[model samples]
Target: MSTVALVTGATQGLGLALVEGLAQRLEPEDTVYLTGRDLDRVGAAVAAMPAGGAQVRGELLDVADPTAAERLAAQLKSRHGGVDVVFGNAVMRVGPDDDPRRIVRDYVEVNNFGTTRLLRAFAPILRDNARLIIVASSLGTLHHLAPSLHDRFDGPGSLDDLDHQVARWRDAVADGSARSGDWPGFVNIPSKIAQVAAVRILAADRRESDSARGILLAAVCPGMINTPTSALWWNVSDAPTPAQAANGLVDLALGPVDPAHYGELVRGGKVLPWSPASGRATVVPYAATTASS
Candidate 1:
C-alpha cells in the first residue's frame, strides 16, 4: 500500500510548505492531504501544487471546532484505512484589544486543546510506526516561564495535571490578574509549552497501550519564520522564510524514526535538551543552528 500524509493548516505559510515538501518525496501512488479551515483556500493550495506525482487532495478542517477532528478521523479511516504521517500545524494568535480571558481561552482552544483532540481522535487511525509531528516554538521553552510553573512542565505531570495548570491560567486571565501571577502575559508561549508536554504524555500512553509501537511522536520548533503572523508580532525581517522553516518540520515528519527522536523538542533538525543540567537558556537563532534546506 502507498503511504499517506496529512497536514493541517495547509492553506499557506509553513503548513503549506510542509505539504509540498512531503509531496516531492512521495511515490506516485502515495497521497498527501492539504487541509485548512477554509475550503476555498485549501482548494487553491491543492490546485497550485505540481501535478503528476503523489496524489494531492484538499480537506476542510477547523481545529478549533470540537467535532471537526472526530469527523476527519472517520473520513480518513473510511478512505485511507490509516495515516502514515500527520503534521499538527494549525495555530491561533491573539489580537490587540482582545480581552485577557478571551485570549487565553482562544489560544488554549486551538493550540493546546485542538492538538490534543486531533491526537486522541487519530490514535486509533494512525498506523503503527506512524510519524506525528506537532509544530511547536522555541519561545515555549521552560526558561520563559516562572520557576514554579516551569518545574510543573518539566517534571512528571499527568495530562490531568497539565489541564489543571491551564485552568489556573484561565482563572488568572478572567480575574485580570495574569500579569501578577505565574502565568505569562503572552498566551502563545504557554500554549506551545502545553503542546510539547502533551506530546510526552501521549508518547508514554502509546507505549503503555502497545498498540502503536514504533510510532514517532515529537514537537518541533520552526524558529523565527518570516511569515505574516511573525510580522504582526515582531519588527524583524531577517528570519527564515516559511519554506525554510518547514524544512525541519517536514524532515521530522518524513525522516527515519529513531528511539532518541521520540518525545523530544527538535529545532532545526536537532534535538534540544528539555531540562538542561546547568540552567535554563533561550534558543539560538535559526541561521546559527543548521544549514537551510
Candidate 2:
C-alpha cells in the first residue's frame, strides 16, 4: 500500500512549500492530498509541483467550515483506510489595526477554532507511527494569557475542558473585557497559545487511551518565513523563504520520531522554552518547586 498524507491550506506559503519538500522524499505510489478553499488554486498548486516521486492530488477544503473536517476525514478513511501524515497548516492572519471585533472573530473562527475542528475529526484516524504536525507560530506562549487560567490548559483535561477555556476567551471578547481579563492585548498571541496547548492536551489523551498506536503529534513553529502573509506582520526581506522554513517540518515527518518534541512546539530542533516540560504541559515553574520555594 502507498503512504498516504494530507496537507491542508496547501495552495501557497508554508503549506505549499511543505508539499513541495515532502514530495521530493516520497517513494513511487505515495499519495498526497494538497487542499485549499478554492478549487482553481488547489488545481494550480498541484499542477505546479516539481514532479517529485509522489502522486500529488488537489482537494478542496476550508478548515473553518463546521462539517468540512469530518466530511473529509470520512472520505479519506473510506478510500485509504487511514493516513500516515497530516499537516494542519490552514490559518487566517490578521493585522493589529483591524477592528477589535473583527480581529477577535477572524482569530477565533479560522485560526483557533479551525484547528480544534481538525483535531476532533482526524485524531482517531491517524495510522500507527503517523506524525500529526500542526503549523503553529513561535508566538504561542502561555505568558500571554493570565496566570489564573494557566491550569485550564497545562494539565489533566479532556478536549471539553480545553474548549471551555476558548469559550471564556470569546465571552470576554464579546463584552470588551478581554484585555482586562489578562488576555493579551493583541489577539494572535492567545490564538497561537491555544493552538499549541491543544496539541499537548490531545497528545496526553492519546497516550492514556491508546498507548500502543505510536501516533506522534506535535506543533511546529516554522519561524519568520518570507511570505506575503508574514509580510503583513513584519519585514520579510531578511526572513527565510517558505521552502527554507519548511525543511524542519519535512525533516520532522521523514526523520526519526523523537518523543521529546512530541506534543510541544518545536523550532529548529529545540522545544520553545515556554512549552511545558517533558511529559508535562505548563508555561510556569512546576508546582512542587513553586510550593517549596
Question: What's the TM-score of each model vs. the native?
Answer: 0.87, 0.88
What does the lDDT come to for candidate 1? 0.77
- Residues 1-293, model 1: lDDT tens digits: 88999998888888988998889888889999999999989998999998666889998989989899889989999998999999999987665445556566777778887888887777678887788888888765676666656766666456667767766766776666765555655666677888888888777777644333677888888888887767866764999888877777777777776677678778876777665455754433222321111
In candidate 2, position 146 carries an lDDT of 55
Give me the runs in candidate 2 sitting further than 4 Å from their true place. Answer: 208-211, 275-293
Model 1 ranges with Cα > 4 A deviation: 95-99, 151-161, 208-212, 279-293
Model 2 agreement with the true structure over 64-135: per-residue lDDT tens digits: 897898999999999999888999999877653554554566567677778888889888788887888888
* Number of the top lDDT candidate: 2
Q: Count the backbone clashes (under 3 Å) in each candidate.
A: 0, 0
Global local distance difference test of model 2:
0.78
Using TM-score as the measure, which candidate wins? 2
**Steric clash pairs (candidate 1):** none
Superposition TM-score, candidate 2 onto the true structure:
0.88
